[model samples]
Target: MGPVVSKFINELSKKPRIERFSKLISGLRNFNKTDQKEIIKELESVMKAMDKNELKGALTVGVFEEIKRMIEDRKLGSDNDYLLMKCIGYWKAMKNIVICNFGKSSLCKRFELMIFEEMNKKEGKNEKRLIGLYESYYLLSDDSIHENLAPIITSCLLKVASDKEESPETEKEVEMALLALSEGSRGILVKGAQHLQEITRIIFHHNDHRNLTQLAFQCAWRFMINNWNSNSNSQIVVVKYMNFLTVVKRELEELAKCVDWKREDEEKENSLAEPKATQIIVRWLDVLGYFFIMCNKWDDDFYELVRFIVELFRTARDNEQEISEMCAHALKMLAHNENSSVDAFEKCGVLDVISEELQQLKLENRLASDCLSIYLQIVRRLSNNSGDETDEEKRKELKRKMFEKLEEEGLEDVITSFHETLEYNQSYYDHSLSLNIFDYFVNV
Candidate 1:
């Protein structure tokens, strides 16, 4: 070991936490005094030992300022490869700390420019180069700094994902890029809406990789939900152009082919297929549920979406309450859509499924509270819209058929039983939902 590293390690062991920051800053300042690798490694060790508050203290005393200066001085030197590697290593240790405490510091502007400059350089298909720049960007990417960095970040991520490189390093780059996009700020997603098609393709391409797929889905979900109101001109353009529903529809079809609903029980026992496939389906279902609740433009694919959601709900593990709850919530949103027709729900077997679940609940002599609350809300919405047809004669005919089906399925009796059960148990929220369902039924 070199003299500087030996002394730094000795002092690190002897100094208090706050004093360690001073030693760390001093070590970084003396980057040229020791062998670059030895000094960089020891510096990382010192910085990594500090907790958030210690790192915050370090920041208050200008640790990042030292990093900025060292990186700049090395950039002017000839043998930069070693220092660049050290820089990436340094950032790997400091990224999370910097991200959490970035808001409290005034060094954001310099950090932003430093990252952008590194990312913008043409490094000739070097994965390490891209990785270093991306790591730097990941550390600097905050809601406060995203506006300046988003375009380059998006462009770089799209390029990387499109390249389809296969390596552990490339995978890390793609994952970080996708994470940044996934957690983008409110208008950030809307601003990137024009690239939704490319992002959709990336999602499809990476569907086999669970982490990549999850991040991509999260990105799309954020984009859709964040700009849901679309009150501004840019938001309106985003809503008009982005077709997230179509993507959701296509993904559901793909999932349908992958999993055999009838054999799901057997498949669950295979051990190899346990959580990975289940998690992907859960996230996609979450996206679908949120899409229905937020966007009102699903009329084009309403029937297919409903059919797919209902089938998933029908086969969902009855013992796993959260999955069932998500499916019910999605259906409930669909039921409340203004464009939804009673005939469409009837054809898609939605009405039959709800009735069957209610009957099953009676046989079991139990109520799944959350699912029941949403199911009751669905029933009330459907009943209230029994007269949704425009022509008076057709509206009356639809109302008559809906009422007859409701009676034949014993929905009235089961719903009434649910009300009595909630009242007997004195449940608060679900009891209110049940009362509203009864009001709708009585008025209808």
Candidate 2:
């Protein structure tokens, strides 16, 4: 968008692609050292503006070699601009080039070594360089290069996290490191599963640092989502030995005891009662939902997890829309599994919460519609899934009780209103869940 980048893109768009771009690179280098430094500052911006074909053409003429040479000549921490520009330029070039060609290029391995060396520097003197390296790694999330570099990055992050002397610089380092890990490939997560213990520690130890704590939770969720279904061994390593969920459960328990969901003052000095507390709660809700649903096992821990979520719903004010939606999703995940029971929902007054929230929901908001769908599923499950009531009389009695509860909570009217609104605004059949639930209520 800048003038320099615009002019460069215009020049590169001319005929004879490689010759033009190569000549441009040559021209930039031909400038005197002082001018060249200024030109190099604009180089990354220009590269970023190129399309995939244009980038391929640039790489064909070995532009990365020029960047690499510049990086090699500059001191790591002294000349920060050159290193950051070249490192980021290399990353952008890697992204545009086809992945099949990535394996053949030695750039990934060479770049990994550079990052590894910078991350191991003593006393954190090269914190800026480490930040740059972490950012470059973060930018490579789309590429498979993370499969090779994730372990090394995680190791370095653990070392920095374990350092007792904390500062803004180290916290920023940890934040970026976790950001990179959060975007890591499934292979990166499964292979680096051993680091879950350290990551979990980072989550709780930095509870007051909202960004760090949130990123750490995101990394844990990424790991669980990647490995929950197919890698039981990895799950065992994280959940059983590392006690990842146990630690999270303990944190939630402590929060439940101290934090008031209906508190009028979010600006209170206590961090747990802060606005960011909602974000952390939302993330953990996602993690706990996916973990219990995918793991496909029953335990008292899940019951307790459901209890915490339900309590959140029961106490959360009507203005807390995000918490309400996530609670719906979390409860749906737990109830969708056969091993779990809906008794927790009934006892925790989630039915009352759902009924109240549904009446105020606007189906126009995608989240509200999705929440409505989840609430419908949970209601349907609790109504239909008779776990051990084999006797006909007992089954009918349970069904009657559920239906009576639904009626007492005015669910039929709320659902009918939802159906009418959707029919008027959008395709009636688009919300087949609402339509079907409406039909279910009518048939009963």
Candidate 3:
């Protein structure tokens, strides 16, 4: 049965008229979702079998005109959303074939521009529907399409960002569209950084819906980071963008606290599932870490990012250890970055909080060796980078403070263990050198 159906699809695909294909697809509307899915899969397979030359021959101006006419027909539009969806599916499939066959030729690029312009004319609620068509194209299309379509996608994203009436769903769709379009287009991101001021305004506006604001900020961070890494001239703009991230990070932290309270209330009432509560906190921490990485500029804002991590450790409850661990991991990554400043780590009191936690865990017999290892690494990094004599004094002060912390925590043994490892490595190297010399002399 499957082979017969496959053969039929292949035979139908050979027909020159897209109108006939549209009619055939429309006839499948009465089928259930599973059957519809199977037909769509079959259509994709059949389309894949046809060469680009064949597909291009099939996609005539007359066929597009007919599809446009069908879209305009109110009865068809209302009764057959599946027809619109399949048209989108077919166009996307053909676009991929052209890209794979032709590479980045002017022919493929011109076709993309024409399709985008046609889709842009779609109006009312169908604007979203049409945008989905382009989005599918963007996702399935090659990176070569980015050179032609990125500006269009950026313009659409800016329009959506500025629209006062744009709903959360539209905002999300637009974000996805932009992400798909920008997948490998770092050049486009560099060109788009000039618009960050306006984008930041929309994101930081007080009445902005939460999810939309988060998505916008996420996009902005990606745009800023991509440009910053590509062009040194973008650093100032990137730093300004980091300031905005600090604000959003604070809001996310507050939101996490609200979620914590809500979870406690639900627990008291026995109304919340454990998985849902866990998801809420996990997402919050994820956002927190994302923003931290974005604000990695070696400035005051970077210190604020570290402070956000410290606050998580200081305020987290017993049940929120997962959140605490996530915060610790993020801080560890930040500390590892060579560009990160020691002053920021110190100003945020991160080391103090870590030492305090280590002490508490030791008293409870729960101090993992991993925590001690992280502490030792942090100390080594700080010591290695402590600058000239003037700064060397500050480094000594920091070392003194660390020793005091060890005494307070009774972690003298952990410090001794770290020194013992260093001494053992030195002795091992010396013995190995002596054995090598002895072997050489005996051979001589």
Candidate 1 lDDT over 1-444, as tens digits, reads 867667766767677756764565545545554455565565456555544345456655265555556656663232333343334323333222334334344444555665655666676445555444544444443445456566666666666656766666666556555544443432254355545656656655556565455434554454445435534443333334444555566766665466544555445444332233443455566555555555544345567767877777777745333455567767766555554454556668766676677766642232344445545544455454344346444445545665776678766777666665565433543334444445535234
Return the number of clashes found in candidate 2: 0
Would you estimate the TM-scores of all the predictions? 0.52, 0.56, 0.51
Predicted model with the maximum TM-score:
2
lDDT (C-alpha, whole model) for all candidates: 0.53, 0.53, 0.49
After superposition, the stretches of candidate 1 with alpha carbons farther than 4 Å from their true spots are 1-176, 183-246, 260-273, 318-322, 362-398, 420-437, 440-444
lDDT of 1: 0.53
In model 3, which regions exceed 4 Å deviation?
A: 1-127, 133-152, 163-201, 204-233, 238-242, 261-301, 356-376, 410-444
TM-score of 1: 0.52
RMSD of 1: 10.9
> Comparing 1 and 3 by lDDT, which wins?
1
Q: Give the alpha carbon lDDT tens digit for every residue of 111-134 in model 3.
A: 465456666665544665555545
